[model samples]
Structure formats: C-alpha cells, structure tokens
Target: MKGKNIRLLRYAVQYWFLLFCIYIGYRFYLFVRHFETGGVSPFVSRPPSVEGFLPIAGFMSFKYFVLTGIIEPIHPAALFLFMAAVAVSLFFKKGFCGWICPVGTVSQSLWMAGERITGRNFRLPRWVDIPLRAVKYLAMGFFLVMIGLIIRTSMMVLFFITDYYKIVDVRTMKFFTEMSTATAVFLVVVGLMSIFYKNVWCRYLCPYGALLELVSKLSPARIRRNKKACINCGSCSKHCPALIDVQHSESVSSAECFGCLTCVSYCKGEGALQMTVKIPKKGIRSVRPVFYVVALLIVFYSFVFVAKVTNHWASGVSYQEYMKLLSKQGPTQREHPRLP
Candidate 1:
C-alpha cells in the first residue's frame, strides 16, 4: 500500500510538471507564430470586428501581464491560478513547485544535462548559498515598492488606462517584431545561465515565486517529517530541488521549500514525511530571522511605492493617442497598443 501511494504521488507530480511546460510552451509558440507570420497566433482568436488578435484579456498576473502590457486588474483566470496554487499547496504540500513551475522543470533539465556531461554533481557551499538566497527577498521588496504601491496608485493608473496603451504603437511593434540584437543576446545569456546554475534566476531572482513562497508558508498544507520513524539518511535533502533540509525539520521551511514531492518520494520509510494541515504556535511563525525582515520590507516599501505612483512619474504612455499616432502613420489599424 505504501509503495503504491508513493508511486501515485510521483506520477501526479510528473503529470502536473509536464502540463505546466506544455502550457507555457504553447504561449511562447503563439508569440513566435505571430512574430514570424505577421498574423495572429493560433492560440489567440479574433472576432470578426477585431481584425487581428483579440485584446489581451483575462488574468491579473502582474509578472507576466505587466511585461506584456498594462496590467488589467486581477482577471478570473489569474485568480483561479492563484487559488489553485493555494489549494494544491494545502492538500499536497508544495506540489506546485514539484509539478507546476516551468522554471523548476528547466532547472531539472539543466541538472540532467550537467550530469550527462560531467561525471560529478554541482553543489554550492553554505557560505555562498545562504547569502545568495537573500536575493529573492530583495527582488520581491523592489517589486512591492515599485508596483504594488507607487505605480498602482499613480503611474500605473495612467498607463493601464492611457499612456501604456499607446507606447506599443506601430513603431514599437516594428522594433519588437525585429527584436534588437541586444534583446537576443540577453535571452541567450539567460539560457546559458540556466545551464550552469541549478536555478540561477528562479532561486535568487523571481519575485513572483518569492510572493508565492510567502503565501505558501501560511498555507495549512505542509511537509511533516517524523524524526522517530527513520534512519538519518539524507536522501530527502539530496533530492530536494529547492535544496531544503527536509530531514532535519518537522515542518519544512516554507521560504525554501518548493513543496516538491522529491523528499517524500525519496524517503525510504513509510510515513517518514507526509503532507498535512496544522497551525504553528504563535511565536513559531516569526521564529525565522528572514521572516521578520521580509515582513518589515513589505510594509516599509509598500508606502514608498504608493508615494511614487501618486507623484505621476511612472514610465507608461497612453493608449488612445498611441492609436491616433499609428493611424496617422499608416493603415495599420489592426495593431493594438500594448502596455509596457
């Protein structure tokens, strides 16, 4: 029974991880299709009145949405994804990290490649690893200060409602359509970095992942390690994609733990680790030194962000004038202005 349970859990993780890659890959393919063909991507359908792809609608993922265009408020799909992430974490204890994150998938792919090329494995020293982990927190804080407060109130409003909409004019489209050499080089650099480091970007950078980790810590679903059940074999930690020391902690550290089922799958004994929901003691919640700093930074920078946005100094340009400008230049009425 235990063996069957473990197998089932592993399969579930594999399926979700696969699905995540397919979804993101599909999105990328769509972008490339449009970029190459000068026609709408297959993934995006346009109504008769709409000459090209339909206006980007749905989802309030600031990370992707903002990068693509001015962020619309949280869409149902983005909210659904968020809720789904929470639900999965609650029930499966970070299965999302194990199964859903494309970045994690990429990291694992690189690790496999490294193993194939070099007979040795990669491992960072504790001294370098500990401080490097702080990078994500700092990046998250920067976003919170820049977007959540400052831009949302001041600059973001103008962009989302106006200026940003215009910035993606025909000229801008042409520029991106002919992606600059610099942008191409940047992408190559990112790809190379992934091959060399275990999750170079995701580990020390991704603000979105940092935010999710913060919420996951509050999630009832957590990995519970039963120290009494087993030998001190370090298989669990060895397999951990996020490099968490699951063998030592009763409750896996939320900040570092991706809720990947690697530790659970690798554990030799049955019931050594299980996902469960339970509240921590009041003081236990703030026990980690990093937690306090994260909390303080979020609070402090949120105000700064708000002040900057209200000051009307944000970078996004307006939508209507952008359209007029494009219309004046040519008959490219089909092009829609995108947000920065």
Candidate 2:
C-alpha cells in the first residue's frame, strides 16, 4: 500500500477511536447523574471502559494481582486495560499511543494544525530537549517507588476495599470536571505548547507514555533503514512527530519511536525504511503499514476478549454500592456520610 493511503487510514482510525472514547465518557456522566439527581434522571450503564482513565488504580490492581495471584474485584477492568496497554507496548512498540490513545490523537491534531498555521513546529535545542524528555522518566520513577513503598503486598487487597479507593474513579472524574484554576491554566498552557511543539504533554509530562516508551524499547518489531535504497531527501526525519533522525539512523532504536510509521510513509523508496521483525531463521520480515495497524488492533482486542471471557472486564461495584457511595458525593450529601 502507498504511504499516503496508510496515513489516511491512520487518521480515520484515530478519529474513530477518539469518538468512541467520547461516547464512553458521556455514558459514564449519565450513569453518575442518575445518583446525583436522586434517580430523577434515567440511569445509564456504567461503562467499564471508564476504568481506562483510572491508571493509578489500574497500576495498583496490576501490582496486587501480580504479587497475590488475585484480581481485585472493585476495578478488575482497570488491571486488564493496563495489562493490555503494557502488552501492546511489549509487542508493537507503543502503538497504543500512536493508534488508540485519545490524548495522542488530540496532541497530533494540535501539532499538525500548528505546523500548517505557523509553517513549521519548533524543535527545542538538544540540551533543552534532552532534559525536558527526562522529566517524564523522573516522574514515572518517583511514582513507581512511592507506590511500591507505600502499598505493601499484604495491604493490596485490603486497600481496594476502602471507601477512598472505591470512590477514586469518581474523584478522578470530578478532578477534570471540577478542575482548579491552576489545573485549568496548566492544561491551557500545555495545549498551547502542543500547538508549537510536537506532543508536548506526551513527550515531557505523561508518566504513562514514559512507561510505554520504556517498554517499547524491547519490541522486536522496529523500523530499520536500508541506506542503499535511500535517496537522502531527509523526508523521514523531517516528518517525524517524535523528531527522530530516521534518514541517518540504520534502525529506530530511540525510545521515542512509537510505531507510527510516519517515517516509513514519507520515505521515497519502498524498501528504504521498514518496520520489520527479525525471524528466528529467516531474514527480518518487513511488515506492511496496513498489517501493522491490523496487528495492533488484534493484539489489543485479544486481551479485551480474554478479560471478558474470564470475567475480568467488569467492576464488582454493585448498583447499591454505587448509589450509597455516589449519593454521598452527590448534591444532597455533605462531606460526612449520612446514617441510614
């Protein structure tokens, strides 16, 4: 397939996933509204996909599951979704961010628009860029250490049952809907920076992206350059959203290579740059852009499929529990819980 077609398909996929996420979010809002409105509004099903936003909860559940061989029932989907993301990075080189993450899609759209409006996105100098990139890693390390030390293995399942943890998703939802002035300002600044620089939040601030990027470094599939077929037009490097120098590099070893294949799509020669997997005996088998995207979908959904079949996808939060918890968080209740 032509690179142009691949890129076009990529846009379609990105927008479609973004829309789906919006749908999930809207449904979740309605679900919460039923409790808030004292059943005056119609009830909507609480979407399990909303658990995707609860990554901190997901990370904790995942650690608990790994150590105890028991899945916390409160937010089982969080662990599964988190596992799926890590699994995607493990096999497909952070394609989750490139293909599925709504944040990445929004970031890409902002930067692309900025490029068209400003004639080009500005690249930070090496010294500045390198240190900024380290910010995400440092943040990731800090959380990993803190969460590790604070939540011991013995306290894992117990922590999940706490009222604070049970209501965390609600807390997260309120965090966005009821953002403080500082958070609002910070987001605005990040959005403007994303306009001027490529993926400013993902590149410099998102610890989740940092974790995925680190895991993607181990992916067997990678974009390799065939220098002999290169025309040296530097199109690959110029178009790279991650700012990777694809023209000079033999293989994309950078953690920033997120399997977008923007480099491959822009390359002049068919074989000049390719995302390929090294075979056991056979030579490295090149992956088509179409196949790469399809494989990503398959890998992701396969995890979802297994989770569903094994009853790991839904939250164990019963309707009564949600009503009890969310009502206390609703308009009627104050900070203190009312006695029945």
Candidate 3:
C-alpha cells in the first residue's frame, strides 16, 4: 500500500498524456494527408499541439520574440509548450518528465516490459554509468553553443523565414511515415537498449532532459528525508529510478531526481520521505503529491490559454500554402522561394 499511490499516479499521467499525443499526431496526419493527396481528401484543421515536437523552432521563436517583441507567425504553439515545460521544471523539479513527456512514458514502459521478461533490471558499472550520463550534458552544451550563443537575431530571422523552416513540420511527419532503413535500425537499437536498462535514452542521450535538469536545480520543492523516522531499510533507494541513495541523504537534491515520488511512496517507515518546500530560515513544509500535480496542470494550461487569447496559438500559414508545399512527391522536392 505504501508504494501503490506513486505507481497509480505515474501510470495515470503517462497513459493520459500518451493518448493525448496520439490524438494530436492523428489530427496532424490528417491535416497533412489532405495536402499530400492534392486536397482531394476531406480537410482537417491542423492541431497546433503538433508543434510541440519542434523544440528547436521553439527556441528560435522564443529568441525572435525576445528580440522583436512579437510571437513568430510560424509554430507559435512550440514556444508556449517550451515555456510551459521550463516553468514546470523551475517550480516542480522536472515534474514534466515524470508526469507528461510521451518519450519518458515509452521509455518507462520498455524497461518495465524488460523486467517482466528478465525478472529484473540491470545497472551498468559505476565507471560506465558516470561517463554515459555525461553524454546528455555534452549534447545540451552543443545545442546551447549553436542556438543560444552563435545564432544572432538576424540569422534566426533569416532561417525562420526560409522554405526549409516553413515546411519543417511536414518533413518531420514524412520522416516517420517514410522511415529509412538506417533510421529504423537506430530506433530499434534504442528501443532494445531501453528494455535492458531503465530510461536508457533519457539518462544517456536526451539533451532536452539535460536542459530540464539544469532548470530543476532552481526548484524549491524537493524530496526530503526525515532521518529520525527512517528505519535503516534501503527500500526507497532500491526503487528509485534515478539511482539516488535515498536512505543516506537528508534531501534528494540531485538534478537526476525526476520528482516521480517513487522514493517517497516506497518508504515503509511513516514520515520517512516526503516532498517539501524549503523556506529561507523558516524550515520546510510538506507538499502533497496532489498539489504538485495540480500546480503543473495549472501552469501548463494557463500558458496555453494566454497564447490563445493573445492570438499566438495558431500558425499563420494557411491550408493552401501547405497544399502547395506538400503537393510535391518527396520532402526534398517541396520548396518555397528563399528569402534573399
């Protein structure tokens, strides 16, 4: 019973988000399919939620907004989604990863399937694990250098208005639909690795996860352990997905902690591990899991609502423009006039 709440909550969130993502994907597919067939098929309005996949574009749009004080006409929803994710991490310690991300859900499912087949999960040696974890941070550094520092405002605006950027969402859809052999093999390898290890892609290769980790360090709420209540058992440590040593620590402040509350839920001793907000010189106050969930939902929806009200939620590109761009047989063939 002690561990039941976390499992239930985690599964509930994961499946709910996963289904929502599938619906968004289906809608986007129908929208693109109409153009792929030269508009002969029935039209379906494009779902703005599909722009959630365009994070790099989101960064560019955000930078453009900072520079020009205007939301870019293309992929405006991406910027809103990006902001919501960052806000969730800043306030709730990477709760977006544990509670909302579809990739995280799939990774967890793969590892759970592996456990059922093999009877347990396996961990890499400390030497191998430490270096592998560094990969994500290195990837994040590369993107920061490329997008954050090197790309200037003029360059961003130029890129934003390009045909390539304009049709990027279409290309992304095609990539999955017409997956090449190399891409298929790569995905298969990653999926296989995930089955053997917990969150293999997220722990080792996800630059997005690394970015969230950095933001989550600023979060006030954290997993707090009351050593006085602990009974010297290692159940929390054993169950932790991030591999943090929960029994020994007074508080789990590691950036790797996803705030899944698995550690808190697994603690057999009463009042042993809990989520708490640290106040300056005033000690700490416990934060219920339900409160964390509520806060995350409110922050995410509020930003979306604001975007809608400000006329920044929809793409300025019209269905006619998509039809013209996608009427070509292949992604490479689809081209628009370059901004000189």
Highest lDDT scorer: 2
> What total of clashing residue pairs does each candidate reach?
15, 0, 0
Give a tens-digit lDDT track for model 1, residues 1-340: 3434654654455566567556644453443344334333332321111101111211123433445543343122332344444445444445555555555666667765765677544666889877877888898787666655555334444544543343332333355457889978975775666665566666776666676677666665566787888687888877676777788888785666765555766788767776544555732221121232233234433433442454311223333343344333332335553533
Output the lDDT of residue 320, model 3: 52
Q: Show the lowest summed lDDT stretch of 10 residues, model 3.
A: 331-340
User: lDDT by residue for model 3 over 149-242, one digit each (tens)?
Assistant: 9999989878877778878888888898899999999889989999989999889999999999999999998998898899979999987878
**Cα displacement (Å) at residue 9, model 3:** 1.9
Off by over 4 Å in 3: 280-282, 329-340
Across residues 185-254, which tens digit of lDDT does each residue of candidate 2 receive? 9999999999999999989999999999989988988999998899999999999988889999999888
Q: Distance from true position, residue 64, model 1, in Å?
A: 17
TM-score-based ranking: 2, 3, 1
**Model 3 lDDT at residue 77:** 91
Of 1 and 2, the candidate ahead on lDDT is 2
TM-score of each: 0.61, 0.94, 0.93
Candidate 2: residue 102 lDDT (0-100): 94
